[model samples]
Target chain A: MIDLPHSDGGHLSLTVKVWRQDDADSPGAFQTYKIDDINPEMSFLEMLDCLNEQLIQEDKEPIAFDHDCREGICGTCGVMINGMAHGPLPNTTTCQLRMRQFKNGDTLVLEPWRAKGFPIVRDLVCDRSAFDRIQQAGGYISVGVGSAPDANSVAVPKKIADAAMNSAACIGCGACVASCKNAAAHLFTAAKVSHLSLLPQGSAERKDRARKMVAQMDEEGFGACSNTNECQAACPANIKVTDIARLNREYAYASLGTSD
Target chain B: MGALRRLLMSSIGKKYVMGLSGLLLIGFVATHLAGNLLIFSGSEAYNTYAAKLHDLGALLYLAEAGLLALFVVHVLYAYWLVAENRASRGDEGYEIGYRSKQRTTYLNLAPRSWMAISGTIVLGFLIWHLIDMRFGLRDNVDPTFERYVDEGLQSEDGRPLFLRYERAIQILQTPVSFVLYAVGSILLGFHLSHGASSWFRSVGLETHGLGGPLKKLGVILAVVIGLGFASIPIYVWVAGVEVGDLSAAEARERARHVSEQALNQPVEAMTAEDVAPAGSPDSDAGD
Candidate 1:
């Protein structure tokens, strides 16, 4: 007998219309899955896990989805729930989304990020290596870590340090890509460029970072920023488009005659 | 250089090109509006202003050519950006997210979606405007600046005395032309209101603190300039002011009124004859 616990909150019944793709090249379709007796406090991924367990018992193909560090910190878990990246709740990730937010008999449609730059790997999983390549292009500084410097020695101003940390909060989830009409990676690129570029250690490579990261982003077939601002709206980390302005300023200065 | 080309090919670089070109076109429009506002001043002042521009000879043509080039760059790049944005959306759209009627705040949160439509209508109006006035295709009256200068305040055999002023009033009085001008100006207003500051933001020039003020300035400028152009056809049609029939005294009175209203600067009363000739030392002297 399966144990079912009914907590303070009532159990939720959900109908999920989820995209099912065997591989990147295979034709994909949506498969409907009905789940019942799910605790309202269960996270969105937990509900998915319950569905997968039932599928395993029935001797059918379980849904394939990506998740790591069920907490929101890792940025590994993301899916478009009802056409919104990480569901309708703003500034919340999929792993953090509780089932209580939805009512009974609510139908949810889930899909992977659908930008040309992000190729679908399997059901609910797209190859996000494009973002990694953009990061590797020039998202960091080449400062040689000879010896550990005292934290008080290279003291950054509180304001700049705060901005840097804020930008550093980007989890590299492709929500911005999924939400953008143009699928522009400007917000994501701006985050990485602004994060390290705001610090003293990252300042030395500021120009090169903006130029190279932006170039890589464009090369990856990402679209340009049309000022729609949906990326900022959908951002789970609440990263502002102000970083984009800073990136633009840095790029303009770099485009002029170079120092070396 | 390859670097410049590469920069232009980049998305942000293309935005800089659009921003710079848009600003250049706005400057030309401002100058054009100021000059056109002279129509309210009566024949002598209007014709004199038109004639002086003609006297610039090759300089005037150079400026015109530069303006045309700027227009081409702005329009072509705007089309490119729209096409690129379309391709980025992939094969399908969201089934539920970002519903059209949903309101995010008190102010409408949706970015103005009709910018491309408004821009295209304005572009079409521009071509029609050139065909109507510059080519003199409508009434077969010569609208050339040199011709206006030659016939200033002088009655030709069986023709209007104030050639340039008469032609302007006649064109403004036409119903079709008036409606087209009115609609075009409104569309242009919509285009400019969003575009002026948006270009800056797209290029990353607009900072957080300055965004609100910059947007306000853009909308204000758009309304002022759009209404300013639209007013010419409306005032002409309503007042039924005969440009060629005004006597010298009436002309002087109107010129003073135009200076006070349009320029917002009071000037000493001066007859048409009192005005210094073009290229005179006082006229050429830099302020």
Candidate 2:
């Protein structure tokens, strides 16, 4: 990740309201931190680093947060800022959110992604491993990579590949969970269903994948989709709600044990 | 009997009860409005119309009883269905259930889902309506049927209470009441927009060539009901005329002032982020 140079003497100050929780099943509360002289060009994560450094200097426990790769691809840096997922920029991840985007004296309200499945871990951090568990339930191809047939030999249709790519665009950020009125994981589950269901190699386990993923999704205490589409708007990848409808159809058909 | 029991227990069946009872209540409103409009022709016409209904005797009583049963069934079913839906959703913030078995699939139609949300809002407005108009001040007749039947009048301290029409006019003359009625009617319009057509589809009435006409009828009914209900407050506001014996011009001015205030009130915009507070218990903090 490129660290842009700070302009105008590297001085930026703002108030941040962050959610703090010690562990799962523990009560949480908001803690306000007054950050001063922050670098305007620094990414949102880097700004958090500056605050943590100050805390460490003061001999206090630094705020715990999550980030990996400092790139948008990892989907690890998820935060709700001033009521929006990944700050104000549409389709932008928190890692890409720069301090320059915010003005001086602006109050930033930060929180973890709210959902029944995602329990609070600590300050600004959540246990998104529920998503990982759901994915592990049936989100992969059973075919061996080395012994696999050639790409062209499989003969995938252009439309199928395009659809698969759309589903594959999902980074599993859980914005859908935070945005949804029911905190449903339909978008994530549907994207996974559509991704593998569209591909030829994954067809063998298609029914099992749908069943297992949906069952696991429910087991995680995620709400059912009332088709609010807030998830679609909040999604960084802009995953269509149509994919959710497709997931419903797939589940319905799969439950009947028929492809048609 | 078993099939009837199943129908009563199902979600669609509860919706059917609501629709059917709603239609019945709409019919009552149309008849009541037609009767009330006679007041413009003078008290004799209005009183005679009331007397004619009273003269029906046992038949009128039976009809009243039937309407009461319908209202009870509608209210009970609505409460039960909403409770069931809430229970099914559990702790989840929202619930999206499969409606594949239902004849008219909301999955295929975008507007249908929008209507469902609007319907919930309208339902809320209706509850307030029943409290305000039916059970509260509008029913000038005492809750006890004995006083209404014996004297053929609204009783107050052992005397025949005059100015039944005046009481209604006073209630309607309030700006807050007028605005509430207007807003409530608008919600009703939205409810009927989706509901009218869905009702026919529910009962299998939209078959063959009847679908087009039935849909048109639905739209017409929605508009007519919305306008009919809205006109009560609008007429009082526009005419600025007091009914019966209440001739308080000051009250009329006060009503107009309130109406203006209600009209001028600014509507607050609700954004997604504004719904839940930052770092609140419900909000997710990225860990």
Candidate 3:
């Protein structure tokens, strides 16, 4: 990923309101912090690191947030910036958001994803193990371990191939859940369904995949889709709500065609 | 049946219910609107359509029962969904300075956020409509409306058919009823606009090629149904077409005159054009 310069001008100073919680059982509140001389080139996560550095120097507990890969692909790092999932820049992840997006003296509010399904673990961090459980429910094909098959053997049409690839792009980011009005994980679950269901090899388990994943998603206590399309807007991977539609179609067909 | 229960009970399963039921209701609206449009064709045309429905006896009742069941299912599931969604959203909201900057295709919130309110408004309107129009239970009764309901289309003694067209015209001409119908029509339109696109999404048809057209179709259907129904009341009020407490023969003559004048043709010409199956009328015009 290209690191864009903060600006042609100078460094930006920002005031951030961040949610602070000791643990899952504790009630969280917003804490204010003023960080000065923030370079425009630094990513949003990098800006958070600067504040954390200052907290450590003062012998105070540093603010906690989640991040694994600084790149957008990992889907580990996410925060609701100014009420938007993954910050204000559309389709951009938190780690990919540069300070250049905000002007100096900007006051930004950052908070953990508030959802019944995604309980907050600590400051700006939530337990996302729900996604793993939902994924474990289906989200995969049972192929015997063997040498890779020839690429031509699949014989997927270009349109289907492109669709499958697009659906496969979802990184299981909780941004969809954060942005959704119901905190619904339909978009995320649908992406997994579409990715595999469209592939010829995954056809054997396609019916069960949709049913089991949906059952698991519901079990995780996510809300139903009202089709606000906010999930699509907030998704950093650019996954569309159409994947959800595909999941619905697949589920209906599966339920009708097979007892499983 | 167990599988059906599992599907309907789950989150996504409940969505499938919303999508399918919503589409069913949309179909009902389009058909209902078509039947309403028959008012312009005059009494004989409209009454013949209503008569055919009434004449079906048990089949008509069965269809009505099915429709009522659909309405109950749709509204109950929708209410349940709204509650579930609210619960999932949690109690905490963003701070005062927080604002959403995400780009969206449509700027209007009526179709997105006003769903519950719009749905409630439409539901209220539906109850009032059934009472006033279907059951003939309103106070200060137009006795002519009661006659239409009691007698099946026409009297056995060769009296003219008490055409539904007249009651429709009379009710629409009243100021309060007209306003209510107009508002109800518009609110139902808003509901349909969101509902149409949403149904497809709920069913998981989020493919790129189809989503845009589906969204557009939803808006178009909403406009057509909303404005089309509103046009009737507006037409009645503006034109000052009075169908005041007429005798059976007089009502028939009035119906024939309007139908002939409007189309410059006989009622048979229009009825001949209606190719709907025996009992359903123009319901199957399109999905």
Best by lDDT: 3
**lDDT, candidates in the order shown:** 0.76, 0.64, 0.79
Q: Give the Å shift of residue A45 in candidate 1.
A: 2.8
Candidate 1 is graded, for docking, as acceptable
Interface RMSD of every candidate?
Answer: 6.7, 12.1, 3.5
Question: What's model 1's interface RMSD, roughly to a tenth of an angstrom?
Answer: 6.7
For A179-255, candidate 1 gives per-residue lDDT tens digits of 88778898999999989888988888888888889899889988877665667777889888888878777777667
Error of 2 at A52 (Å): 0.9
Docking class of 3: acceptable
Candidate 3 accuracy as lDDT = 0.79
Residue lDDT tens for model 3, A18-64: 99999998888989999998988899999999999988998988999
Per-prediction TM-score to the true structure, in the order listed = 0.80, 0.58, 0.85
After best superposition, candidate 2 residue A100: deviation in angstroms?
0.7
TM-score for the second chain in candidate 1?
0.74
Across B208-278, the per-residue lDDT of candidate 1 in tens digits comes to 67877988999898998889888888888778775455445444344334333333333343436655457
* B1-287: candidate 3 lDDT, tens digit per residue: 89889988988888788788888988888999999888777666776677655556689889889899999999999899999988887887656532344445333354776688899999999999999887767765475745633433333333333457777777677788889999999898888889978877777666678877888988998999999998888778888877667774455444444333333323332233232345542232221
- Pairwise lDDT winner, candidates 1 and 3: 3
Q: Show model 3 residue runs off by greater than 4 Å.
A: A1-8, A57-59, A150-158, B96-102, B105-110, B140-143, B146-154, B157-163, B204-206, B245-287
